[model samples]
Every structure is written in C-alpha cells, then in structure tokens.
Target: MIKLRASRRGDGAALFDVWYRAIVGSHDFLKPDDLATIVEMVQRDYFPSTQFTVAVDDADRPVGFIEVDGDSIGALFVDPDMQGRGVARALIAATMPTDRAWTVEVNEANSRARRFYEQLGCVLVGRRETDDLGLHYPLLRLEHSAAAV
Candidate 1:
C-alpha cells in the first residue's frame, strides 16, 4: 500500500526521477531541448531547494510528490506506473488544509492533465502564455476546491 512521508535530505535523486518520468510521460508537447533543460534545472536546483511531501510504497521509496507553493499547488506528479491509482488524489487531499480553493497549473498542451484535475473538481480560473520560467509551454490555471478533492 501507499502512504505519505516527509521528504528527507537524501530524497532529491528519487524525487527528481519521479518528476522526470512523470513529465516525460505527460509533457510530450515540450521540445527535447526544453525538456533536457528542465531536467537539468530540476536536478541542479529545484528539487534540492524545494521541500516536498512524498508518497511512498511499502518499501518507503517515493512514487509521487506534491509541492505546496503557498496558496497554490506548485507541483504534483505521480509515477506514470501509479497514475489513475489514487496517488495524486491522496496527495491533494493530504496537502490541502482547508475546504476553500487552491490553484494548480497544467500545460495547455497537456489535455490529459487538465482533464485529470477537472475530474478532481478543479475549475478553470485563468491562463498564462508561458510557464513561470518564461518557457513556451502555455499554461492552464485551475482552481480546486479542497472540499472536493
């Protein structure tokens, strides 16, 4: 069974692997160079700098992660192998502390992700021409009610 745990100091590599695989599976719209750059950046900077709540299996190895970026879910990615198995839902429910709403961003090219979030009761709130890094991937901003996750 899967369960939740706090990410520890040595979790970056596994976390990075999770992020890379998930992105590769869902973000097929990204260019090879852009994806490579993102992979490098995530490994060299983001994963180490950011703290995440990890979802682990009985072995206690990470299978998914959620990043709580203030009032937003900065990131949420589950292992492609674990997709549609409730890992993402568990992360959202565990991280969201209130019955109010919080936002999540999905790449505009990633219709599958958009539908997944919508299935969790998220509604369209806005859009962005590029991601936070000024990348070319347009983003669809969505707001999720904590009550429904």
Candidate 2:
C-alpha cells in the first residue's frame, strides 16, 4: 500500500532524483541553462526549507513528494514511473488542510499540471514571467480558496 509520511533528512538524495526525473519529463520548455540553474536552486534552497509530505510505497521508498510552506505548495513531483498512479494527488491531499486554502504555482507550459490543479478546484489567481526560482519560465499562480470549497 502507498502511504504518506514526513520527509527525513536522509531522503534528500532520493527525492532529488525523483524531482529531476519529473522535471526532465514534463518541463519541455526549459532551456538547458535555465534547467541547470533551477536544479541548483531546488537542491540548495527549496528542499531544505519546505515541509514535505512524501508518498512512500510499502517498502518505504518515496515515489512522490509535496513541498509546502504554510499554505503554499512550493513544488510537487512524482517519479516518472508513478506518474499516473495518483502519487501526486496522495501527496497533496496529505498536506492539505480542510479549513484552509492552499496555493500552487504551475508552469504555464505544462498543460498536464495545469489541468491537474484546475481539476482540484484551484483557480488561476495570477501569472508571472519567471518562476520563483528566478528562471525565465512563465508560471501560473493557482489558489484553492477556502470559500470556494
């Protein structure tokens, strides 16, 4: 069975691998230099600071994770093999609060991610020309408002 649990310090390397694979597969619009820069930020800055809820398999290997800071989802990535198995949804649901709103920023070029967030009742609240990592990729800020629920 798949279960959700808090991420430990030892899980960083494995989570980085999963994140790399997910990004390489889904982020087709990223330039090589920009991708490298974002990778560094994810490794050095993003992962360390966020509160993560990891989706682990029966053997306790993480298949996906959600990086959240308060009510904002900084990132969500699933292993490429686990993409269609609801690992992302499980991770998000694990971290989501029933009475509060949560927000996420999806790459504008990633239609799949946009669709997923929209289906979860997230509305497009804003847009930016660059991602939070300072990469030049466009992003759509989405919000799941408590009042909208």
Candidate 3:
C-alpha cells in the first residue's frame, strides 16, 4: 500500500536524491549541473517540509513528494519506477487547499505534464520567460480558480 505523510527533517538528503534523479533521469529535462542546482535549492529553501507530503511505500520509504508555495504547486515528483501508479495524484490531492486557488508553471515541451494539469482543471493563463541559472525556458502559467483562469 502507498501512504502519504509530511516530510521529516532527516528526509532532506533522500528527497534531494529523488528530485535530482527525477529531473536528470528524464532525458528531456535539465543537464547534470542544472539538475544538481535545482535539487540543492529545493533541499535548502523550497522543500517546504511543513507543507509538503511524501508518498511512502509499505516499507515506509519515500517514493514521491509534493511541495506547495502559498497556493502554487511548486514541485511534484514521483520516483521513475513508481510513475503511473497514482503517487503523483495522491500527493497533489493532499496538498491542494480549499480557501484559495493554486498555480503551476509547466514547460511547453512537457506534454504529459501539461495534460496532467489540464485534467485537474488548470487552465493556461499566460506565458513567461524565466532567465534563471543562465538558461531561458518558456513557462506556461496554469491557474485553478475562475478568477485566476
């Protein structure tokens, strides 16, 4: 069985490994150093342990995680081996709040992610260019409320 729980203090390094592997292992995303930097930043600042949920297997090993920044779904990742098993869905469902809308940026090149958000009633509001880390990526902002959409 799969269980969802809040992230723990000592789970930072393990979460980092999961985030790094999830990004770098994807042939379509970040390069080595970029993935490393992203993981580092998440571990140091963006993990949002207080507002994050980790998916654990029967053995209590984390298999996926989701981090929220305010109402925005900042990060969601599932271990490659555990993809398509409702891990991502459970994490997302657990993190969404009812009082406000949420937003997420999906890369245009990532069709699967775009479709996933769309299925969750997120609509593309606009596009923006992010020039962080010496790279420019076209990001699509998806919002979950009528006012935001």
Candidate 4:
C-alpha cells in the first residue's frame, strides 16, 4: 500500500535521490552537478513541510514525491521501481486542491508524462522554452471544476 503524507526536512536527501534518479537516470536531462544543484534548490526552496507530499510505502519508505507551486505542480516523481503501481495518481489526488485549476510542464519527448496529465484531465495550453535553462517543454493545465469525472 501507498500513503501520501507531508514532506519532512529529513526527507530532503531521499527526495533528492528520487529527483536525481528520475531526471538523470531516466530522462538524461541533467548532468550530475546540475542535478545536485537542482536538488539543493528543492531542499532550500521547497522542502516537504512546504507544499510537498511524499508517497510512502507500507514499510513507511518514501518512494515518490510531488511538489506544488501556487496552482502548478512544480515537480512530480515516482521511484522508477514503483512506477505503474498508482503511486503517482495517488500522490496527485492527495495534493491537488479540489477547487482550483492546476498546471504542469511536461517535456514534449516524455510521452508517458503527457499521457499521465491527460488522464488527469489536463490539456495542452501552450509551449514554453526555459530560456534561462535552454530547455523546451510543453505546458498542460487542468481545472478541477471542469475535470470532474
């Protein structure tokens, strides 16, 4: 079983591992040093107690995480080993507000993630390029009121 809970400061390193592994190991999106910096930024700017949820297994081990920024999902990652077990869906359902629209950015090349958002009723809004980071991504938006199913 998986449970969603608020993130704790102590979970920083574990969350970092999840983030690094998901982005680097799976997507090859960042270099080790850059991933390290991203993890540090997440720790400093968006720790568990601050608008983040962790998916903990029956053993009480964190296997995934989702971070919220305003009405947007800043980040969502599940341990590769835990994928396809409904952990991501559970985490999103637990963290997203029932009254507001939420937005997320997905890499155009990431078909799985795009499908995940679509499954949640998110639709393509526009395309975006992180000029500062030189990364191109697509924006998806979901309105809770309109997404009811």
Candidate 5:
C-alpha cells in the first residue's frame, strides 16, 4: 500500500526528478530560462529545507510528494507517469490537517493544476501578478477550508 512519510537526506535527486517531469508536463507557460532557474532553487533549497510529506510506493520509493509547511502547501508534485490515479488527492487528504484551513499557490497558466485543486475543494482566495520568484507568471492563491476536508 502507498503510505505517507517524511522525506530523508538522500531523497533530493529523486524528488527533483519527479518535480522536473511534473513541471515539464504541466507548466508550459514558464520560459525555458525561468524554468531552469526555478529548477536550481528547488533542488538546492526546497528539497533540503522542507520536510516533505512523501507518498511512497509498496517498496517505499517516493512516487509523489507534497510540502505542506504550516498553513501553506509550498509544493505538490506527483510523478507525471503516476498522475490521474489519486496520488495527488491522497497526498492532500493524508497530510492536510483537518482542524485548520490550508493554502496553496498555483500558476495562473496551469489550468490542469487549478482544476485539480478546485475539484479537491480548494477555492480561489487571492491572486498575484508574479510568482514567488518575481517572474511574470501570475499565481492564483487557493485555500481549502477545514470543514470541507
């Protein structure tokens, strides 16, 4: 059975691979240069600093991950090959605390991600003109209420 667990020291590369493939498949609006820069940051900073809630397969290999830090979901990415099979949904359901609302930011151009989150009961609460990196890609901030989960 797939289970959720904390990410370990050596999980950086594998998570980066999953993150990269997912981005490539979903984030077409990102400029090549911007994507490369974001990739560097994710590999160097995100993977090391955050304790990701990793969804592991039967053999305990990470098939997907969600970085839910406090009230904000900083990241969520499933292996592109593993999409559409409830991995993303399971990650959110398993890790999100039910007592409080949670937030996430999605690229405005990424319709698929927006739809996914919306389907999961996340509603748009805000928007930004640029991404966290100060790039031109806009962001839509979504929140999942505690009562809905």
Candidate 6:
C-alpha cells in the first residue's frame, strides 16, 4: 500500500533521488546542463520552501512527493519504478485542497504529464515561454477545480 506523510528535513536527499529518477525518465529532452540547473533549484529552492507530502511504499520508503505552496502544487514527481502505480495521483490527492482551486505548471514538452493532469480535471489556463523558475522551457499553466481530484 502507498501512504502519505509530511516530509521532514532529512527526507531531502531521498526525495531528491526520487526527483532525479522521475525527471530523468520523463524529461528526456533536457540537456545535461539544464538537468544540472534543475537539480540545483529543486535542492536549493523548491524542496525547502514548499510543504511536501511524501508517498511511501509498504516499507515506508518514499516513492514520490508533491510540493504544495499556498493554493498551488509546485511540483509532483514519482520514482520511475513506481510510475503507473497511482503514486502521482495519490500524492496529488493527498495535498490538494477541496475548498478552493489549485494550480500547476506542466512542461509543454512533457505530454505525459500534461495528460495526467488533464485527466485529473486540470484545465489549461495559460502558457509561458519559460518554466516557473525562469528556465527556458515552454510551460502550460493548468488549474484544477475544487470539485475534481
């Protein structure tokens, strides 16, 4: 079974491993330098600032995580080994608020992620030429209704 728990400071490294697995598997278009930059931002900025909910496996090993900031989901990533096992869905469902809408920015190039969010009832609201941290990647801004997961 998958379980959700509040992330502790010590979970950073393990969560980073999950991030690396997820990103490296999905964002194959990223160059080494771009990946490096993302790694730095995930470690230095995103991980510490957002409230994280970790999805753990039966043994209590984290397999995925979702980062929530205010009413937005800043990031969600699952280990490649744990993909297609509802880890992402569980992570989103665990942290998503039901009283108000929340937003997420999916990389335009990542159609799989876009589709996943869309299926979860997120609708495209806008677009951007760069990612959230000003990286040079196209982004599709999406909003999830409070009524949907």
Best by TM-score: 1
Worst 10 residues of 3 by lDDT: 129-138
Of candidates 5 and 2, the better by TM-score:
5
Candidate 1 on 125-149: residue-level lDDT in tens? Answer: 8999999779988999998776764
For 1-149, candidate 5 gives per-residue lDDT tens digits of 67888899888888888888899999988888998899888887777887888988898888899987788888899998889988988988888878989999999999999999999889999999998889999999999998887
Clashing pairs in 6: none
Error of 5 at 141 (Å): 0.7
Q: For residues 1-149, what per-residue lDDT tens digits would candidate 6 score against the true structure?
A: 99999998788888889988888888998878988988888789877776688999888888999888888887899999989999898887777788889999989999999999999899999999997667788999999988874
Model 4 worst lDDT run, 10 consecutive residues: 131-140
Off by over 4 Å in 3: 27-33, 39-51, 131-134, 146-149
lDDT of 3 at 77: 79
Give me the overall lDDT of model 2. 0.87
Candidate 2 lDDT tens digits, 22-58 = 9999998999988888888889987777668898899
For model 4, residues 1-149, the per-residue Cα lDDT tens digits are: 88888888688778777776677655565556665666676667656446568998887788998888777787799988888899888888777777767777776657778887887777777666551246343433434334453
- Stretches of candidate 4 exceeding 4 Å from the true structure: 29-51, 131-145
lDDT of each: 0.89, 0.87, 0.76, 0.72, 0.89, 0.87
lDDT of 4 at 23: 71
Segments of candidate 2 deviating more than 4 angstroms = 147-149
User: What is the lDDT, from 0 to 100, of the residue 97 in candidate 5?
Assistant: 78
Candidate 5 yields a Cα-based lDDT of 0.89
lDDT of 4: 0.72
Report how far residue 124 has shifted in candidate 3, in Å: 0.4
